[model samples]
Target chain A: MQRRIVLDLDLCCGCRSCEAACKAAFKGEARIRHGDIAGAAYLPLACKHCKQPLCLASCPVEAITKDEKTGLVIRSAMVCIGCKSCAFACPFGVIDAPLVRHISQKCSLCADREGGPRCVAACSSGALQWLSDDEIKRHEIGMRMVSKDLFFRRKA
Target chain B: MKNINPKAITIKKALCPFCSYGCEFGVIYDDFGIKGVEYAKDGSSGGRLCPRGSAAAMYLNHPRRLAVPMKDGKPVAWAKMKKDLTKVFGSPKSTAVTFDRNVTPEEYAAIIGFCEKVGIENIASTYFEPESHLEPFLDESFDVSNLQKTQLVVILGDPFNQTPMVSQAIIDWKLKDRKNGLIVIDSLHTHTAGFADQFLRVNVGTEPLLLFALAQKNFEGIDATKVTGIDRAIIKDVSRRIKDSKNSIVFACLSFGHTYDPALCAEGISELEGYGRMKIVPLVEFAGYEGNKGFGSIMEMAKKKKIKYLVNFGELFPFYYPQVAPDLKNLEMYATSTLKHSGYTMVPVPLTLEKEGTVYTSFGKKKLLGGIEPPSGARSIEEIIGPLSGGSGKGKQLSVPDHKLDIKERARRISEATLVKGKGLRLMGEKIAFNFLGFFEEASLKMNPADAMELNIASNDIVKVTSKQGVEHMTVRLTEDVSQGVVTVPAETPGARKLFEYDIDTDLRSVNFIPTEVKICREE
Candidate 1:
């Protein structure tokens, strides 16, 4: 019933346009971080906004919370300390550790904009997609990578 | 400028001047100023923008934007600067005019017309990116959708990082069928290479040899297997597949210091283009306006004291080419810039985004709407040339020098360069959309894990990279993306770009280099 950002690994080319869009919109604080699969694959890691969020539980000051209706995990800059507990507690490691204004970087999913998220809009490869639960279930998310055709993979 | 609500947000549609894709995006502006970039859904790529396009507004509203004329690193009155420039142009015979990037085709034509009207003879292009070597392929613009029908695609450099807009189509085309062959040839294990049907990991600076071999063009003393570290049988089979394939395209995204013989590399692409009956699609960033001669000839004239006053009408010139600055010490430079740079008499000029003109792109020419006004104290090229005496005439088109190449000689030199054991890692330049102008991301060095361990370097270790031109500190990223003896740094940042050493090839009459020898040490 909720909309979330999903990544199609098969389409990503690791350009980092999504991060730039986020940083540009948020005044230089990148909520999304990047990871390399041993230089074999590049992934842009954004907040999964899980059903049972751990960042919301790890926040000592209770700065992180999830909206029950939209399922958006939001972080308040005013209520937060610079302790980085939420960043450490994040299982996905999507929360960036380096503090720009002494606050853990968290993705708000471009809540201010009407078009869902800016990362999906500026995705050059169309890899990052913000979709509703129904659309997410209909599309084959991560099954189309090299597993179907390992002939292209020189070394797994 | 329009009758709209003061508080309402508006987006001005403009073509991205960063690269040739020319994807249309919007600059979000309200009553205050430029807010950010908006991805236009109906635009070329259907709202998909690269990092460079996304950061356009950030660059436009950067704190370091030059808003006034500067001389000797000090702000000077525009009147005084204009008078001084007019006096400098009094002796147009000794003056030379050059350009690089950020100039529209109309602006380039205006510059050339002004040069002809003012009696300035020495006009040349100073843009020497390896992508410029792919100029011949730009006669016809190919759409990205063509890749879907392509039976094979042989990519030269990392298109994923250099030009990310094409990556989606490439991936879809590769996955739509099982037989769609994708051959990536590079020294590094790039993201595109990971998706490659066969990645020919070549020796450093030996890509040209592999290309030539694939084209079936053999030269004396050139054993592609020995020189490029790629097996000959594999090369032969891949070459056969490409030739046998019905539709094939060779996508070139060359970077600075990535090739030793750029002209020869272009020739190799040409050979492949003809042999395989395929088209050559160069992912050009910006094909700069050319002059009657190459920048090498202009530099020669400057060194000989023939050119005293150098006036550039582009964003990058003497500033980006730090290595060529010392040679032109005898000459005076007055360059136009949108961002604050340290050298020369910088004339604050409006970026192409604010100008109403046409720009040459991969998909032919596109027009800049010029809805945005020029920054205060900044002027356009046409406005700047108003005071100077000249009746505008259409300037000459790209009269590029004919580079005659001897395949055997180039192969020999490249083979020798690859065979020579260097003391340090071979520093190759890379381009990433996010690292454009170093505004979005910091420069990081990509090296192989084996090479990193040998130098006692770890991932994220701050390492001091020393090249012949300069030294700079970069965070090291240990990955198999780079070859063992090769390391790549994005050339978008001046700190990393200046660390590259450039050489002017005599035969090509163009500047090119294979890779710089950079010694890296972990900063304790």
Candidate 2:
């Protein structure tokens, strides 16, 4: 029952709605996680919900854990201390530093809201999508057989 | 959130008044005043907002903004303000006036009318007409779509990346399926040069030499070790790229006013033609400003005639064309402006919603007098243009518009009629967006080009920039990236204007300091 965020490159118009929405959902203002050029591409990224979570293993305080019900990686805010371990451990630099509060924060898929991740909802281009593990795997397998470049491989 | 009315958050499509890139922005108004602003969806800025546009809300609410109209340096009511303005301009006297073009068209017309009534219509001057074209950018025939076909692009004065939209377009073109090469010939390593395939750091003001040498395929003194301070092999490599390209496009970002050497562009035009189909594009800064270049063309025509009364707005004819302003001392002057030096100065624009009523329209118009709710204070350009165009029957005579009123079209009509007869060639129209204005404002560094990495100059540290006409003290800003022998200051600042040598003398005080190779030193 693991959930992974799926990307539809075709729908991704290179508009930065997800980036802005992600910042607003987690933090009050839209803060770019990295330099502009890095985020220029029309690629939306989220925790892959890998069979082995790199963040959970990397957390020294055991602050990060995969939810038993959803198999989604979750961070324990109360127990967590701001350390660079989880950030270094995760290959993808999804780890973000909240501008207001000096603490580590990441996309929680807007767990507090009933409607799901705010980024997914606010994306006017429908570039980012929520998907179950099976669907993500199926799409990846289908996409892999074709050109690996998701943006250019779309069939006419 | 104490029973906040949904109507309180009213979003009005307010035009950004900073630059010629008249970006329509959505100003969010609450019952209290302006809350925030966002880029209007329909305007040239699209949904993207730049730092200037984003910070506009702060500018609107800044405490230092001019809240009340002023007459003789003191606050006065709108009626008294208009009366004082009328009295000063009532006589036909030659006066120098500097005015901003952002005044509503209605105010523009009213000011023009005021000038005519007072017989001061002949010497009205504003910022350079060509520079102001950067605002209210119009869709031009010479567009990016035309640029895509180009294989070569050259930038002269202003760096491109500092102006992002244009830079982004050029970048996209360079990174296209079949990459197009870019050549940046500038004095410093500008951000625009970063994306260029090759950078030619030529000596400042020596663009003419570079162009001539390139045209003749002569490498006499252009050796990398000598001219550009680069490896000899690198020069050969870049020259090879230029020579090998089939379709070459040359771009110069420096204003024709500052650069003054049109022959270099002519040489570039000729060289590009030799290769294949080459086009030379002048990147003008103002909105509907292409019309101002027509004035330059007109002044050339006027030299042969015995005509009088050259009225300019958002333009300074003498500074733009030295051949004109000096000979026209008998030329009557009239204009309304926010600056202190203008022959007719009105209230300064204070930044805020509360003090907004204090700022009058460009024509010294008070808010809609005795009207309910007063139309929210900000006047539209169209409102000002109508009255000045003689709709009110109080202003000078103007040619009637045959078609629906458009600023670009009206400007063209006026330029055509005003041009000393028989010389009117249409120049290409230009399109600039609001966000690009933000980029220009944000990207241009205020540091002096000569000094680097030092800041502790005397509090009012003025640097002397000596040309033949004498020396002027410009405020100094120190940064590393600025090159020696070049001084970069904000073009709009008062200190910078003082540095601008506006004189008729060819050998001394000529505005063409580029050719003079004047040295700048920190003033004691």
Candidate 3:
């Protein structure tokens, strides 16, 4: 029932349009981060929204909580003490306190928006997708087959 | 701090002033000021904007924005600044004005009228290459809408960085028509190349040669692999695919040095006329180029005679014309009206978002800047230049010069000529990142992974790049996108300008296409 954001690494061109769209949708904060891996692969990293939610557990003040309906990990600025505990606990490094604002910030998956995240809408290459758990599994299978084909072709 | 209520927000339609495309966007403003920007549904961009367009509001109220007029690095009153300007323009014959391409039509007309009245003949706009490239293509009656119907599309350079909307349109068309072929010919593996069905990484300044070879349908005796750094078979295959397509269009950006030979490429593309329909679309990437007609006429007159006093409006003098900076300093008087202080007789001016005027889009359509007020005290070009014109000068009618048609001979000569191999690395300028002002920043030397390894250089290491013009140290970035023997720096950086060879020819005045050879060494 919960939605997850999946990225197809092969489709991304490192344009960072999703990052820009996220910043525009939010108030000057981009939840999604784009970078290159040793000049070979383009990576667009965002909140994975793990079932355990390490960031939510690590918050001493209980400022980070998981949404009951969408299962998204949300951070509250009102209760946050700017201790950066959630940022240090999160394994993915998606949560961080912006220099201007002391509160820790991360992607909310555009929970309030009608459709989904703005990053998904802004992706021109069809690399980013918001889908249910079952849909993500099926999409991952298809992507794996394509990657395998490309890998074998390169090897040949 | 004033809390911005969502209910009190007002959406105003405005044009993106960054590039020449002039795509429309809706500015979300409150009583405090601009809050954010959104894509307009009925805009030229079709409800999509580049990263810069999405963050347009930040640039409008930048912390460093020029709010008041300054003289000798100190703020001055409007009356005193006007008196200083009058003193400079008192000698009309010796005074000249040059403006950035972002001027509105009415403001441009006012500047032209002022120049005519003052008999100032040394005025020129920042963007002059588009005048030569776009004029000839537009005269041929090339329609951009035809891109959707084309079966094959060829991009010369990175239009995605310059004109994202145009690039998106071509990509969307390709996605819809699965059989359509897309070819990207560039020195680096640009973002546009990611969507390309075939990407040919050619050597710098060798675009004309490859295009000529394709037109001749001959690759005899020459090692195509060595000259173009592309396989001969791939070239033959792409050429065959181009010839076989029904409708083919070549989208060429005028920002690159290789694109200076647009006439040659146009002629080469025309060779496919018998097989199929072919057209060339000259892409103008910068804003306000359409209003540069008045500025172009002044540049022509200045070359014919010497001028002493000069005024610059919204134009970055040394950034665009580095060679003329020394000459400008030697003048009797020099004044600049700009958003950022460049240390001339400074007169602060408002940006496009703060003014109401008409601007010509890259597509040659008229668009209005819809804001009601100029930023508290800042004045528009018309408000400043109008009073100085004395109201006696009528606007001058400008004409675009005809493009020379003797490109076939040059193409043949190029095809017969040998590829010149330079020692060490070939340095090129590329657009890297868009900052708050919609201009490129983070200038670094992007080297190929192989070249980086050979030089014992790692990513993010500082390196010294030396050209005949000068030497500058820049951080090194390793990437597989660039070819092995080439190093690329951000086109907007000072290091890139050092590679430029100054030529007063109107065609090459604004664009640098000469292949600059540089030596790169690790800085210890």
> How would you encode candidate 2's per-residue C-alpha lDDT over B247-302 as one tens digit per residue?
56665455422432333333444554464344555454333211212232233334
Name the runs in model 1 displaced over 4 angstroms: A150-156, B1-7
Model 1 clash pairs are none
Model 1, residue B493: C-alpha shift (Å): 1.5
Alpha-carbon deviation at B372 in model 3, angstroms: 5.3
Give the winner by DockQ: 2 or 3: 3
Candidate 1 residue B372 C-alpha distance from true site, Å:
1.6
Query: Model 2 misses residue B449 by how many Å?
Result: 12
Write one digit per residue (lDDT tens) for candidate 3, span A1-156: 888888876455455667777776676677888765544456588999878899989899999888778788888879988888888998988776776888888888887655677677656445677789899776753353263332121110
Best by TM-score: 1
lDDT by residue (tens digit), candidate 3, B1-524 = 77767668777888877666667878877777777665565876655666667767666766656678876678888888788788777777666666665566666667777777766655556553332444445423445667777789988777765555565567557655557778888777777776676778777655655765555444455554666667778877877887787678877764433333544554554554333455767666543432333443444445555566667766454445554454355454344444545455666676665567666555675557666344676776666766765553446533334435555455444434326555778776665333323332346778988988888999899888887667888889777777778787665454465564433434323333444578888999
Cα-based lDDT for every prediction? 0.84, 0.43, 0.64
Tens digit of per-residue lDDT, candidate 1, span B231-263:
879988988998899779898888787778778
Query: Worst lDDT window (10 residues) for model 2 chain B?
Result: B423-432
The DockQ assigned to candidate 2 is: 0.05
